[model samples]
Target chain A: MMVYVIKVGGNVIDNPVLLEQFLADFAKVQGKKILIHGGGKIATRIGDKLGITANYVDGRRITDAATIDVVTMVYGGLVNKQIVAKLQAVGCNAIGLTGADANSIPASKRPVKEIDYGFVGDVVAEELNISSVKLLLDAGLTPVFSPLTHDGKGQILNTNADTIASSLAIALSGSYAVRLIYCFEKKGVLRNAADDDSVINLINRDIYQTLLAEGVLTDGILPKLQNAFNAIESGVKEVLIGHADDVRKNTTDAVAGTLIC
Target chain B: MMVYVIKVGGNVIDNPVLLEQFLADFAKVQGKKILIHGGGKIATRIGDKLGITANYVDGRRITDAATIDVVTMVYGGLVNKQIVAKLQAVGCNAIGLTGADANSIPASKRPVKEIDYGFVGDVVAEELNISSVKLLLDAGLTPVFSPLTHDGKGQILNTNADTIASSLAIALSGSYAVRLIYCFEKKGVLRNAADDDSVINLINRDIYQTLLAEGVLTDGILPKLQNAFNAIESGVKEVLIGHADDVRKNTTDAVAGTLIC
Candidate 1:
């Protein structure tokens, strides 16, 4: 069975029209199962509205109590459903998931003792329940994920979608043909943020880090690249970082964005 | 000083046109506020298309690993942003949130060790941060939330929107005038679900059980009524269960729905 894992970025998620378009394209991927992982952009937006200032320390969202309430409502509630609706509208079988389901992605609190960060979590793949994934894929449903998860304890923590995608890819290591698709605007990861045409085609961990060091990969690309590395190391076959529009282009000759091997 | 906690339902959220209409009415509500809840129907639609059978035990979704992934994308990614964009389009400064940010809602995994119900979570309210709510309200912006939360560990879980709403109402009890406007197809909590005219004017905890016992209320009303009761008892001044059409009406006199005292 062919299983493709797509990691959608916060920026793409912020744009519903673009996301809708991506869902349409996702429906066209024939003979393969699809899985999606999304970030908390919507949660962030609601947090901003509710006077909840989200402080990201060390690339992790520092969630407090009030913020957690809003995040739950937006990420798992509104945004998760909307994507499912879009997929279904165009006739794609989509299933939505969070870290809590099946204990799929075993997570724990970030362990920041001083900040009192309420529900922030990190993914632990080894302890995840991968059987649930096999069951869904066996039945032929596309899995879409939110970045919420829990430690074995009752505490559910906020997780990064990319990290979830990576951990999930590893947890289901030999089960599915996992491909991480980081969809954003600007045609892919450009050498510079301003140029859309300068998409980087392929990179290993070394080149990815080098670009990061050289400041060629900036903004959102940095976290995504790191996730790409993590995913590849975790067992995902190919990590495709490209424009949401270029998802279908078959290319051994390089398409758009950076591809991590 | 006036903060309205509007509980927009999954049904309304499933239909984009209805969602837009809801947003239009929602924009009319003036206050430093937060929108708390999730969209399940939309997720269900996606699940159905994907051939994933969704099982809900006691109104809570039973998620498998793959289902969790699908839900996260749909809720955290699509539905949340669509609402935010709609709000923004209408000039309503709205932001979306998931539980991870600011530890909005401290979540823990459902501790039923024997039952392998994947990804469901419960809230631990004390861990949430309310400072964001204060800031957003101060800035005259509204927060739209999705029901995805974390348990402080590294896992993200799916949570009930009502639970999140109640928790937030209690958390923000000291400050805002928290009123839950549960928008649904029903006119109000009918003395009988079949009779729209027989709306229950006021329901105290004692009388609520009586209504259920008499077969005057059945089906979904039980949980909603109980949730409303919990909210009021927890300090929310009002709980209005009505159709979206009646949202802008004179809520002071219990316009058209069940008024849980």
Candidate 2:
């Protein structure tokens, strides 16, 4: 059986109109699937309103104690529950989750280096409780995940949605044929960074090497590509990078994104 | 098999020490169980920080638009996840839930009469998707629910935790010998309103009638007793009204609370 593990970002989550359309399309996709969602500006906005300042270092936001609580409420609570309800309205039996639920994704708090990331957690793919996830999927339920993991010591930690998506993809590969999809603002990995139409339809290792040698891969797409290839090496059948609008297509044979084999 | 559906209210929730002690005892109880928690002062505290007002009518808190969103985040998100994590830490395999999750508890928005309690949901016992809940329990996962349900058409509604507890007890009675326990600040149903130690060990319908005729019940305990008797009438094996500290003992043959049969 094939399972689609889709990751949708803050861009889609922040916009009500886009989120509704995306969820409708997502609900219509056949077979087993999981959704990992990113925490949008809503958390930061809510944090600001609550007098919790967002701390940043090297252009990345820090999950301080207060910030972690804010994210836990906004991302795991408000945003996640709202999405689940809407999906149910559209006939999808969606169940929302955090890593803390059922102890599904046990993660370790990030070690301190030059700067402390506070309550951010790093998940090791091998440690995921795939059996519980498989249990839900096998029982005809869709599990929706928030970008949060726990330290197993009663602490919920902020996690990266992209990382959660790929890690889950890699972990579930053993049980099913997995197509990991990263839904973003753009169509796909562009051959010409300036033109959205110049999407690279396919990228095997050979093409990736050639593209890298030619400096065609932009800095923004570098991490996403590296993450995708890592998923492939870890036994995920395929990976797709596409616009949120093309999620359903990316799940099928007529993929409208960068397909990494 | 016996399934205990336990509900703990805001008094325990607002105090960290009390909550930790309660959860440890709850985790140590020796059978299948489910926990439904109340929205504590934390929601109101957080809502105040976020500039959402707490509206009240006739001394009852109203679930207005902003208040519902705040409760969804605080009750379903922050408090629920934290409890799940802590339970996991104590070796209880807890999975946090709202009524919206997995559509386990379907509800309808309360219709307007004298008051339009915005976004408040009233759950019907038969409408609960007990199979999903049974699956999780059979899989050895303990469910920890927040006082949040959904209108089937995409709205998360604030529900009374006591109602949720009794409703689940009634619904699960067909599958298991159900024990519905409501844990609050008091030791048990009191013989004297002024004395905390005046605990009534047991109450049957005949005893209840005599007590009602004598007006032994206070304004606060009347609703709880009524709810408990309703559960008994609906096939629940027993209902316990006790302090949160006595949860484990209340689950056993050597009970420590007011047992209604």
Candidate 3:
């Protein structure tokens, strides 16, 4: 059976109504669709309420010991559980986990220097347990994951969710049809951020790099393009970048967003 | 020479004035002190403004391909650079990184699962480039790291700051004096969340397991205690769980929080 991978951004989650709409629509998909979500906003909100001030140097939130505690408590503990409940409420059999459960994602904490940021981890994809995910899928349970993971030493560290999806896309690409659906504010990938008419269609590995180099594509657009190329090269059949409204459109159509192969 | 690792919490970072005060205080530290910070709240806020959402499962942020892009732009691109600027403004020569520049944190994406969560990743601490940290410290530059890291696959993944701190502590433990200072809202690790006087001092490995079994701890505290133990086992000398108020206190005092050794 063809399997689709969908990444739900944290912005969608923040707006419960928008998330609900997406969930409702997601449930109607004819085939199996894997869902990944973001919750940094929610976690940070709770952190703020608890008088915790989240810190970022570049763009990464430094997960110190205390922040990891809050993230595990909020993101893993509360947000993940709640997302599962919501999916379940809509009749989606969703299971919740940290990257450590069933070795879904094996990891180790990054070595700290110049600063002691605790509990921030990096993924060890080689050690990932694909069987665990298969088991959940076999059981018809939708796995709702939090970015929280663990180092081999048994410490749970806060990690990124996007990398999780990319890894999954590569892991399942050989066996199943993987579709990376990114729900963003823009209708799709536009040639120019301001001019929607210039949405590019079908980008290969070489062209993607050129755009990135010329600075024609910069900022947030960079990693997405890289991830799309990574997924495509790894065997994921197609990559779809679009807004929430275009999800149901024929993925191959230019209306949906940028298509990368 | 003795080196101590000090982790600054997000709470202090949220309040610019308080953070400035901290920077001033840190400037006065006599010996070599490595600082790590958490910046999730602000990152999330900025992501929201940019129409991005931050998601997590367990404790990991769901970094789908697109989300990873947004995160890198936000965390590594803007936030990390901004922090370096902030520290520099305070006369602290700081260098920012996304863990990829120096291969400081080697990582891999979790295996693709039934569902795709995009670019989420975890750490490979053993493969970390600690020499990069040493180089910066040798030149008197305080390295400020954003939580975004690469999986050694030319992909960047958002990570929790805390795990970064812990891993760094463990890796550097053999060479430098490591002290993990986690400041939070609570004054210290309490025997009972309601009782401030229930502060416990000096928890070893075995007793921590006892506390978990006895249900004396729950939620995020469980993971933190586990991380504390892991750090100690991994060779980190001293771990302190306390409040930001005590940041300036005598580093050796068992003054207000739980001490893990």
Q: Estimate, for each residue in A74-154, the C-alpha lDDT of model 2 and write its tens digit.
A: 999999999999999999999999998988999999999999999999996678988888888999999999999999899
Say which prediction, candidate 2 or candidate 3, comes out ahead on TM-score.
2
Fnat (0 to 1) per candidate: 0.05, 0.91, 0.00
Taking chain B only, the TM-score of every model is: 0.91, 0.98, 0.87
Q: Write the per-residue lDDT of candidate 1 for residues A1-261, one digit (tens) a residue.
A: 546676666677788677777777777876455455465466675567446788876665678875665565567655665565456556665556556544566677777676656677867666777765565566555667777775655344677777777777766657766666766666777876777787787888778768867978777677777777877887887787787787765222345667789
Candidate 1 segments whose C-alpha is farther than 4 A from its true place: A1-261, B49-51, B250-254
What level of docking quality does candidate 1 show?
incorrect
Give candidate 3 regions above 4 Å deviation. Answer: A113-117, A250-255, B1-261
- Report interface Cα RMSD per prediction: 16.9, 0.5, 18.1
Cα RMSD of all models vs. native, in order, equals 18.4, 1.0, 17.3
Evaluate all candidate structures by whole-model CA lDDT and list the values in order. 0.68, 0.93, 0.66
The DockQ scores of all candidates, in the order shown, are 0.04, 0.93, 0.02
lDDT by residue (A33-98, candidate 3, tens digit) is 677777648768756755678998777788876576567655654455445545554556555555
- Could you give candidate 2's per-residue lDDT for residues B1-261 as a string of tens digits? 899999999999999999999999999988899999998899989988888889888867889888988999999999999999999999999999999999999999999999988889999668899988999999999999999999989999999999999999999999999999999999999999889999999999999999999999988888899999999999999999999999999999998889999
Looking at candidate 2 chain B, the ten consecutive residues that score lowest on lDDT are B52-61
